[model samples]
Target: MTLYARYSELLDTVLDTLQADGTLPDGIERRAVAVEPPRDPAHGDLATNAAMVLAKQARTNPRALAEAIAPGLEALPDVSSVEIAGPGFINLRLTDDAWRGELATILREGDSYGRSDAGGNERVNIEYVSANPTGPLHLGHCRGAVVGDALARVLEAAGFRVTKEYYVNDAGGQVDTLARSVHLRYREALGADIGEIPEGMYPGDYLVPIGTSLAAEFGDEYAEAPESEWLELFRTRAVAAMLDFIRHDLATLGIHHDVFASEAALQAEGAVDAGLERLRSKGLIYEGVLEAPKGQTPEDWEPVELTLFKSTEFGDDQDRPMKKSDGSWTYFGSDAAYHLRKAESADHLVNIWGADHAGTVKRVQSAVKALTDGRVDLDVKLVQMVRLFRAGEPVKMSKRGGTFVTLADMVEEVGKDVVRFIMLTRRADAPLDFDFAKVVEASKDNPVFYVQYAHARVRSLVRKAADAGVSLDAPADLSLLDAEELALVKLAAQYPRTVESAAMAHEPHRIAFYLYDLAAAFHALWNRGNDDPGRRFLVDDNPELSRARLELALGIGQIIRSGLDLMGVEAAEEMR
Candidate 1:
């Protein structure tokens, strides 16, 4: 059993014994009893407020309960001391052997040391990068993609059955515009000038390659065909190429979606019609004129009666139109069906959207409630904008043609590891300033380098041990590890708990910060060795102690690797 598990069990015995002795009531809730490291590390190793929490319920003073509980805990197997602090805060000091116990557990479990079943085997579908297929994904999509992918991996690590999905917006007028753009590109491919890309045509040079490929296939035939005969054909090929490009872009970041759900396909079998009919049966679908939108209502505001859904019933600000006056399905209509399809497949749906889509949150949430009859929850995580920098100046990237930065460009410039890590350095809702020059720096200010250096030091120690002819077989003579090394081990062991909490909160940046702390702990211990010779990891003459220290180093190295793996960062073995 883990040291934490044993500690929890011993604490339980104390609580139960206290209840039996009438120091506290028997029917108190035990869920809030959390044993975690104290905010001020000097106070103790671990702290809990069990007595304080139960005081109100038991109608007794917390200090009295903690005093009664302390003796029961002090008698346990690994107990060093149990002290009742201010207002019944129980601070427990474990035997040095308990610290040794943490190191031993790390050596035994390695990468899986911090793994937990905290997710309760629930299924979650994380949908992200639902960007339009109009063009290649710009820099903005990159942040959401990394955040969502990392969160999905974290949830999986925490034992949730996670499905990483991408919703394709293939049915909209945007695709039609893309088709027309490709048609223009088709004409240009057949040796036409195309004349300044026209007013509305997509002007990206990337489409030149698609047009060239299409020309090679059709050989001037599509250029001569009418819009009706060639629109669908070019649209299909163009979207496929766009999707292929997007897929390759995601692959560069080590992200792969388990499902690529098509919004158009949801309407192939009249599913949208059937879904709206269902809403109609439930009295949600109605014909009404929407109140003019605030601030920007047109002067020609004719109250045209259109079919609407009473989204306000499910907490939306106003009723929404599912179909426009032309009887074409609106964007929200397809989204509602898509969410319904998602509800049919997964236990829950989570969407990662950009800040611009923030206002759409309530309507989509309301639609999901109406579609599922409040059976499924649609949680939308709004990721704010990301600004880029290079050489300490802003790197301006416009969304227009020839001005934008592709996800590939950023990844190519600084590499995927640096790109992914920097993107996750801030919370999704917060703005991130990513400076390429600052990220690759080798100093302590660069968190990426600092964290990787911690791992490399461990690797160096492991190499030194092998060179010194020490056997790594014995489960790490952890008793030789001092206070600093023990603290590092304990911090590393909290990774699984950190990931569980981060995933539960829809926050991937937490893992980024956790790595920083873990790295800081390792750095602190490394710096300690400089001031104290006995604390150094290598002792050439004392081979036994050297082996145990090597084991601790290897344990730290393993944690660095595991943590880096989760964040999709590279764990550098040696920083040259």
Candidate 2:
């Protein structure tokens, strides 16, 4: 158990005791009670709202309830003091030995220190970076990819069976456009001087290789044939080739999905029909005409009777169309079918989509709820766009990708670690500026560098300690660590709690944010050592103190490495 969790259990025992002894009434809901470090460190090591949450149920004022509860907490081992302050909030102060023992726990657990079973091994299917196979992945997909991948890692660490998934929209019209685009490139490869790509066609040169390969394989067989003869053939081959390209791009960023659910395959198996039938059995599927969209002129809006799903019954703003008047499945219909397929295998489903799809979230969620009969839940995380910049100027589009900077270009320009780390420096729904110059800058302002530097400095310190004849295997007295060093240990001890909360919240960015703060704290301690030699981690004249401090430094390094691993980033031993 984490330090916070241990205290939380003890706090729960205290509350239970209060009820059993008649100091507080029974059957009070303690779910709202939380045990966490105080907002200001000066106040306490840990704080709980047990008294505040239970006072009304106990038929007593919060302050009186807190006073009745304080005695139980004060009796716990390692809890040196417990103070009730400000409207009955209980603040706890533990002995310095508690923080030192946490550091020892860090070293003992090492890389596995923050692992938790909070998820109870529930199955989670996370679909992310499901970009169309028409082109290379862009910066927008990059952000979602990192966020999704990192969340999967965090969830796994928190004991969830997570399936990293990608949905291929190959059944859409976009792939047909891709076929026409590839055909143009094929014709050009076969010696046609195709100048200036058409406005509606993809103009990127990345398709040139696919066309050249097709020309070599089939010669002129489909070159002069009609569109019908080669459209399916080209679409199949082009999507496959583009998928290869996308896989390579994702590999550069260290992303690999365990499952790639294809829309074409789903339709081929009649999943859409089956999904709609399931909803129909529940009376959710109906044929109706939707009212004209908001602000539409009555004459301009011609309502057509379409097959619809009663999404509003499940909390959507309106019923969603499952099929067009001509019987073609709507995007929502196929998407809902895909979700049903996932929910069949997984206990929960999560979709990481661009912010542009925000309006569609509710309908998809409703579909999942209706399809699963509330047995499963769908969590859609919308990631906003990323703006690329060089220094302070906006970066231009990629010639190879045609419209925007490709994920490959960004990964190649900087590195996989930098790309992954910086992409998660903000919340998924917030706009991120991928400043090429700023991310690579070796300064505190750059979170990637700052966090990596903290790890690297610890490595350098260890090497320097070894070179100075300090015995690394020596068991040191942890009591030698001072208040500032113990404070860093306190910060490091929160990793497990952070992992649990981040996993439960489905927010991997919390890990990144926590890592940066931990790094900042470590860096602040390092800076202090420069001014006071006695405070330095390596004290050449005092080997005993150095060994104790070395233990502290190594514990910090272990946390940095573990946290970076969760983010799919490397703990750098040396920075260039």
Candidate 3:
């Protein structure tokens, strides 16, 4: 168990004892009491607000309660001293043996050091990077992909059964556009002189290969077919080809979704109709005309009575239309059915979308609530834009020319690990600037490089110890570790708490930040050894101390490796 968990258990024991002795009231809720590290390490190694929180309920003075609990806390095996501070805060200083035992646990658990059962095996579905099947993925989709994939890994490490998912928007008009573009390429491949692509058509060269495949398969068979006879056939072929291209691009970043729910399939199976019927029974579905949007009404806007969902009843700003004027289901209707299908089996649903979709968040959440009768929880995380830069200059974009930088282009420029790490350097809702020159630099400014370098430095130390005939596998006398050395171990011991908090908050960026802090702590300790030879890991006259310091270094490395694994990053044994 982690030192923090041990301390928490001890605090619980103290509270139980106090209650049994009739000094505190019975049935006091202990869930809000937290035992954690002090914000200022100068105070103590650990601090708790148990007395402050429970005193009010127990009808006693907080300081008196803290004073009453101090003796019992100081008597605990691991605690060296306990002090009552301002108000009712209790500060604890643990023994050297406590730090040593944590290091031993790290060496024993290895890569599983931070694994926890905080999630309790609940099933979670994470949907992200559901980019349209029209072309290769672009810079906009990259952040959500990395964030979702890393969150899945983190949740799984916290013992949650996670399913990575993607929603294929093949029923949209974009696939038809893709089919027409492929047909243009098909005609060009057959010796027809098709000039520059007409306006409103996809002009990307990625479609050339799909066209070539079509030409080879049926040599002009589709050349003379009517639009009705060939539209569905071409749409099917184009969507499949685009999905293949997308899968390959995702593979480059080490992302593979466990499920690909198709919007077209949901529509064809009448799931949308069934879902609407269910909402209709709840009086959430009705035919109504919506008022013009307040801020920017369309120039040709006209009132039309259409099928609408009572989204306002469930916290949306207004009732949302479910059908278009042409009697076809709107995109919102399709999405509602898709979420209903998702809520059927998963205990929790999470969708990672771009920030531009912020306006749609409320309506979809409302739809899911109506569909599930509030039985399921849905969380939508909006990832902000990512701007690309090279040498501090913004990368250009040309929407008319279809010349945005694709995900494939970025992956080819930097390695997959670098791309994944840099994409998560900021929170999902914050805009990130991915500078080509800065991310690849081997300096403290680059987080991934700094963290990896720390792990490699520890590995280098182990190699040096082994070269001098030191046995790292043997147990060490951990009491030889002084304040600076023990401080490093304390930072390493926070891994379990970090993992649990990050998983519960659905924030994978926390893991990245924690790893960087750990690396900084390790680097600081290594620098300290430069002026003080006695503090160094290699001591000529004291091999026992040297072996113990090596164990501390190895334990630090184990934690770094475990944290990196959660982020799906590879820990380097040596820097290039």
**Model 3 C-alpha lDDT per residue in residues 485-574, reported as the tens digit of each score:** 999998999999898888888999999999999999999888877999887887767899999999998998999888888887888999
Give the candidate order by descending TM-score: 2, 3, 1
TM-score of 3: 0.97
TM-score of each: 0.93, 0.97, 0.97
lDDT of 2 at 342: 96
Stretches of candidate 2 off by over 4 Å are: 25-27, 298-300, 398-403
lDDT of each: 0.83, 0.92, 0.91
Best by lDDT: 2
The candidate 3 region of ten consecutive residues with least summed lDDT is 222-231
Candidates in descending lDDT order: 2, 3, 1
TM-score, cand. 2:
0.97
How would you encode candidate 2's per-residue C-alpha lDDT over 1-576 as one tens digit per residue?
Answer: 788888989999988888798987778788899999899999999999988998999999999999999999999989999999999999999999999899989999887899988889999999999999999998889999999999999999999999999999999888999999999999999999889998889999899999999999999888889999999999999999999999999999899999998999999999999999999999998889998878756776788999999999999999999998888888999999999999999999999999999999999999999999999999999999898899899987764448678899889999999999988899998999989899989999999999999999999988998899888686789999899989999999999999999999999999999999999999898888787898888886999999998899999899999999999998999888
